[model samples]
Target: MDVTQFFKAPSGPASMKRKMAAEPSDAALKRLRNDEDNDNDEFNGDEDDDRFMHGDGLTEAHRNLLDIVDSAEEAPATIDLPTLKRYVLKLEKSITRNEEMRVRYPDDPLKFIDSEADLDEDLHNLMGVSAAPELYPNLVSLGTVSSLMALLEHPNADIAIATIQVLSELTDEDVVAEASEEGEEGMKALVADLMGHQILDVLVQSFSRLDEFKDGTDDKQGVFNILSVVENLISVDPTIAEKVVSSTTLLTWLLSRIGMKQFDSNRQYASELLAILLQTSRENRLKLANLGGITSLLKAISIYRKRDPKEADEVEMMENFFDALCLALAEPEVKTTFLEEEGVELMIIVLRERKLSRMRALKVLTHSMTGEGGAACSNRFIDALGLKTLFPIFMHKGLKAYKKAYKSHSDSEEDEHVLSILASLFKTSTPENRLRLCIKFSENEFEKVERLLELHEQYQARVHAADMQFERDRIAREEAGGYDGDEEVDAADMRYLNRLDKGLFTLQLVDLVAGYLCTQASEDLVREHMAFLLNRKGKDFDLFIKVLEEYAENTGDATSETNSERALILTVVEKLQIISSS
Candidate 1:
């Protein structure tokens, strides 16, 4: 498969010639035509012009069959199994007959043009299968998919586009997902069958033949259908998804297609496919990252950093770029390359200068600083002067600033994410980096630590309110016969399972920072704000303590000696204990 098929456009006459050459052999066409003749003698005329030929000079039998299929395409109606299969066979026969006619009448443009119209109608009939997916298995067994796929390489662009539409309808994600929910074999089986027949290679061949920039309607719709088919396939199975993203031509095409300045449905879909592929597997993510996918993605997103996409479709395209980038950064290889390419600088610029993309940049940055890549990203983040840029936003005061900026309350997910990144920095900090971060906070008279404590208190209050609400709701439910005999226990289990619902991770993050400050800055500096970390909802303090104890216990098994992060957490636990005692 030429991975770069998307880079080139389909040729006009030359492409048609190739399809003409690839048509079924003379014997197969003769057999199919004979079968059609036997089945539809009434439509077979006597004279050369009268016999199976239209005003456009198409075969009389072929023209009549097309009329039947055309009416069936009027609405989302299902043709019975026997009739649908026969129609499929008839369509294949028509395509085969057309190929034979093209070969026999190489000089007869009228013959080939009418044949192409018949092929288009037959493809439309097959697309009606989208409304009746239960018949998909029968269609597959009848070898309809393989035949349609072959038409993708058809000489006529309209015929190929029509074939693409049929395939897209057959493998649409929603159609397949709905089928899967009902335990029916849908896209999964269809894609597996397609993969068996080397559908990807055919797609790439068709892709290289068409140019998006200069293509006519048929060619453009062809591009859309090809991407749609691939998207549907990938969304169905992991193995097939891997096979696709792992393709060098496909990866390159997707990257190039999305970078085009003209935003359209196909470009938007290409962006979406890239994102889904990356999100599906680490291998896909790594594959694209290695292919300079990140650079392509950032360039696309950077276009919208300062300026908002005016059209809704353009906005969706920009969103796909952001989503794809976030998933891409999850790969360690991509993260290292991202840092190497000054991606952090771009994100900083977005946050600092671009209002529309500010929080999106924050999200990308947060995802970048997580998992195995977190330490590397954190180190690079500091080196890129990320701290100088991030801390100011983190320390911004007042509701107006909050609403205008991140629009997150003091302990909203956005704020929690900012704290999460801080925790990651401290968790992965070298002593040198640790001291630098501490000095950053101290430079502003430790206002950063004070704010962390203030945020912790705010979250603690919310946790308290949540606990009260849960208790009240629980009591009300118990008195109102809301519980089944086993329901009370089930409710308790749910509460236990969601122990972190009270923003425990964010609270721990605050303590993680406070613990770091205590080790580097004056203990009194942390002590002044230590009370801010105390639980506001009476016995809820025990829950906070339990979270810290669990962290210490988990760390004790992972390491023989206490790391600074663990030690700092223990220090925070000790301080909280002191506050509880007092």
Candidate 2:
């Protein structure tokens, strides 16, 4: 039996089939081949005759058939809207009918397989809705969504798989954003309905049934299909993604699935989904961390840490693992988990020994150390004795060489991140750790401080040029009558302030190191480095004064750092003045 003939609305005259089977006229052949519009006069058939209408002629039994046939001729033919609504009704009815058949033939399981397969094919045909997602409004109103989601938990796995296939078709990624409507109402309405009906729970339930240990063909396809549907939903709306992570066992399952060591697409997809979920929510990250996710992630990537994966997807999977670990480490609670799992040791091993995951490890470490809530992580670094390894990498000529090779400031972002990490580490340091940091940099004739000064000069020049350019541009805009308002000026000013402040943070870090050496180190060490610190170009003195003044204005005399740092700055000022006088 022809499958296309199985499901369609009735069309055309009954006698017309015989006429169509007969040898068509030369005119009919020409029209059928190219759909060319030839004048009616070219054919000798009378206009008033019923047959001349070519099956569209008005008849007592079916006058509307002609209009329906005309509409069906449009390209990429779909069942008409009314017929589609009726088709949805049939799909809803088939679900109940299939359940009844399963009950009736309880002993003969194969009896319902063919019916389930046919129903699957019917659902697959619904892909035509992509071109006309507007049709989704009516289908959703008819409770087709509820019926389809119910099948995801059917006793027969085949029925569940078929439902997944249909859901994937409805929410395909490529068509979600391209739905042509006023504000994409079609796709938005479809997703809203899916989410509102808790499709996440249904989809996750389907995913939970698949066993990766079984190499069965159906099981593998089902896993792939379910992942695709979940990806599509999350890609369309982030709220759905949050719901997916919070509402299901998916995060825990993905944590296990990625460590399967199979090197298959399923493992690769699991890695990707885990990264997306962790990045989507801090709660998701914390949840995964609580489930021993950080350990699982480290174990999976440990294989490829020493060398690259052979396949592109495997490499991507590993990178996703890296990304996920980075996001998880941002949470303070997860940082505790990291300590328990010996995560610092793992990252240090990657940095010190592994070439394949070296850059990625640096990024994870940087994210772990830098930022507002990383004081505890910074303390962990000290307790782990990470400085023994970190200082060598920072002072290596290779880092400076890499910084010099890039011309664009943006290209040096990783280098800046490294600097930020160091600054953050020092920001939360105790007196003992600060002295230890000073001793580490003073090795090899103070090369680290010299490098820090060089980097500070470079960023200072960039910041100065940026500030000058902004002023010039602001003047130009005002001269051309292009000053929009205070909002635009204020926004631009805020951006400039951020750039200036970032530049100053690095410079201030250098000042901090110099201040520590002056206050905490022996007098001989401060004297030895005094000229190098005071004599650089790029307004180092002005920046030092600016930082000092900001601290004074923002903090009171009661602040411990303010009082201590003020005394250190004054002492450094006297040394610089004495050097200038000499």
Candidate 3:
């Protein structure tokens, strides 16, 4: 006869099992009554017998047990509107009692400890609301949302942590997915209410007070729960990512946290959150740049520049930092900041070191030296003697053996990034640096040009195979009457997309690099080496011109910049055509 069982809410199967376990069997109760009767006979007194008997020929204790069992049987099996209201009422009372006790006896833990424990239990019990997220609006209407939010600033860290756990559970993605359309609307209203209550500001401020090392597990879990809450909120409303960085100290806290020397779960989580925020909006990216985020990320990731991460989690953290840096570098202003912080030099060192960071560093360089904003980075890259490192990778030298010794890496992926670096230099470099680039192809007996042609053939074969497949699919579809009479334009568009997907894009890049070297490099040597390679493959300059023509035709809108790039590529195509005619 557990009194706790009388108060327990009718949760699902688990609660049923607990209720059955707590109840006494009928035989056990009968035996107990018989034992009580024997004891009564031993006492042999009317007063004792009268105290045990009731008017219905049963003991008063046995009748009370029957009443408890009846009430338990009559309890609602699932949470509905009335049950939710009761839970809310219970929670509100617990919160009020806890706050009152804390206020009345601020200096005495003993006086308020029981109330604090009760409040904590109530907060956790509220997590059952997540199962009925469609009722979130009702929870909000009951005014407990504010009470729960206020607990984020509670004087007790445990209370704040418990509140975070509840919020995290409520906003969880699985819960959101379980919701219907009406439930989604309810979730929206709930989140809107939380935002109106300054949720982001409160969450950011909590970071300073919640020390993860203070109580070890509890505090660590508190910090993790806080991150989960933020992640859940963002998942519910992606636009909150911009609001998070724009309106609060979260970005700043994240930057400082990840910059800490010691590696921990919170630090890793902070890095991941930072990456998510930066990837959300251009405004977020620009904000990071203004805050010296580039410098901070560089310092944090520099630890692994020469060495690999010790564990998989650290590897993930390092990748997050790199991801954040690359996203930040998308902004022109951040690219400038990246260059000013000697980011190009660091990347070059990373490339030369050939650590796990090498491939990612190459990706960062490709981003840094892309588009019109990358001119300065391109110049700084050459000025830093980055070519000495770029060429060997371009030629695929020593990479296979290194890949075997350390980690398996994609040779094609390495080739793509290296070729991208070269393409960027061709597009963004000054005349002097452009000559320096062309000389790299010439200095190694046209070795770079030869490698370029080999890649061209390789990707050309891939594109050819894909084109054949597309043709076969098209023929089958035509035979089967799969095409509408008016879908010729649509069919042509799909073919182009299929080609791009199956190496046409990389093939265009290869041809673009070859075109650059053919026209920009020394006329006799590079053209001859390229022509000799093409001819040896039983191809000619016409192949390069065809790829270039196709590339320029699809080179996007005819904006002045696009027109200029298209004009340059067309000029290269014309040159190749003339060279072929000769």
Candidate 4:
């Protein structure tokens, strides 16, 4: 029967017709949604009162009818086929109003589906049809789904497209749930079936529509409907993604849709859906090595990334797009394709200088190293000093990102690069494996430190010279009988003294000074910096405390003083439970 015929028919499932004499009538639906019901605390409400009142929503007449039906219910009510079909139509039409209607008829949908005897066997047969390939050789089920997919090919294009959209949105949850319930073996079967059949047909037909599609309106509804269908089908059945991507022919169609020259709404959605398809199947990773896919996609993203840097959604889209594209390094074939097409230089350029693209590159690199071939290729690139250029960025706080965070205080917390690099490092455990990762970053950093030390000594002598001048001036001023107020010390000298003498404020300068001693081991630089920054500036007693008690506890000093610093350090270590008991 035509779909319209089935809708108008008087016979359907067994449970739908089985309303008892005491069942609540349609008016009860209005009672279910009324404000009084919501306030009554049991969570029942008038579904009609929903904020978005639509023409297709539950009308007062339908609620009264449901109230009449509910009032008639009694135990073991026998609903006839005729009455069941009527209720089925009512339920189907009321679906658009579902967010509200489900609340009103809470027991009906569950009871209607749960009982095997109550449901139409044909409707239930739609469950995971793709799981058994022999079952739906035509790519559409015989009853419910067949009727739905057929709607896409209907002559009334608007009606067909709308039907496809509604059907996809409406049935997607149930289809996915059914596939999930079957588990992996069933899922693989379902994916393979869709990959071989329905997926190709949809792409071909959708692409064909582009020729006739108009800019203003002829294309919109159909394009959106097509994408919605595409999204629904692949979202739950990712196995088809590889099939769509690996076919060089399908790849060309996708490229033509949203690559550099095309940026319309349909193309935009196509790009978005393409991402979803690859992401779900992880086929996107493969596409990075696919001829024309990566280069074209990145070219598109470079433009978008630059054009809408401030638009958070665009940034997120760019992120997902590249991340999936970068998964190319996984297969040796794909890796070769990548360097051959774009080369190792592209990876470094993206990492070193491309604004947001660097993050996407890191993400892809992380995935690439996840696979054996990718790990080896990435090692070669790094041995060439790619990582050396990037590692310095992680050492300095708040220096990694040039873009401001849309979220608060996240900028102060930690570097994204540090987290990214650490994640990449954790993949391997052996030192022979990890040593190449060190990038000799500390060597150059240490050389810079030695240079800084010479400057530090020069600075110390200048400060001491100023102190001597102050002493000379003080004696001369007093000798003159009355010291002129103009005997004020230079601003620079006073600033230096304040920094040297202050407490917590001096810690900032101490950290700068102690950082020069970074070549020491076991996080010794951080330890020394923390302690040295804490030491009192220019006080001989405090200096003795630092040298004898904290700095060189292994060496006994020639000058004798009480070792309060050592006691304090030991106390702190004990409280923290860092050292073990004998």
**CA RMSD for every model?**
10.9, 10.9, 9.2, 21.0
Give lDDT: candidate 3, residue 447.
76
Where is model 1 more than 4 Å wrong at Cα? Answer: 1-76, 180-183, 397-411, 443-446, 472-505, 519-523, 529-547, 550-582
Q: Which 10 successive residues of model 4 have the least lDDT summed?
A: 11-20
In candidate 1, residue 65 scores what lDDT?
54
Clash pairs of candidate 2?
none
Q: After TM-score superposition, what is the CA distance of residue 189 in candidate 2 from its true location, in Å?
A: 4.4
Please report the candidate that would top TM-score against the real structure.
3
lDDT of each: 0.69, 0.65, 0.81, 0.44
- Considering every candidate listed, which one attains the maximal lDDT? 3
Better of 2 and 3 by TM-score: 3
Q: Tens digits of per-residue lDDT for model 3 on 112-211?
A: 7788778876777677677778899998888887998888888777778778878887888787888899878878888888998989888888888866
- Model 4 stretches with alpha carbons more than 4 Å out: 1-144, 174-203, 210-213, 242-251, 261-268, 279-288, 304-310, 352-354, 375-388, 397-440, 443-582
lDDT of 3: 0.81
Q: Per-residue CA lDDT of candidate 4, range 250-354, in tens?
A: 556656666645334455566666666555444555654555676776666556433344554455556656654654444566666555555455556665663
TM-score per model over all chains: 0.77, 0.71, 0.82, 0.46
- Tens-digit per-residue lDDT, 1-582, candidate 1: 221222223344311111211234466456558866775664534654564354554556556555545554554444577767777887988889889988988776665666666766666666656656667667778888778777777766657766776777777777765664432565556777888888887886788876666634456666877887787777777577778756537878889899888777778888987887777688888878788888888899888667777777777778789898898887788888888888888988887763566667888888888766778778878887888778877876343664665443333666777777787787676777766777776566667766866776776676667677788888888788788868878987666445457765566666566555554444555544444444343333344566676666555344657365567567767866665566
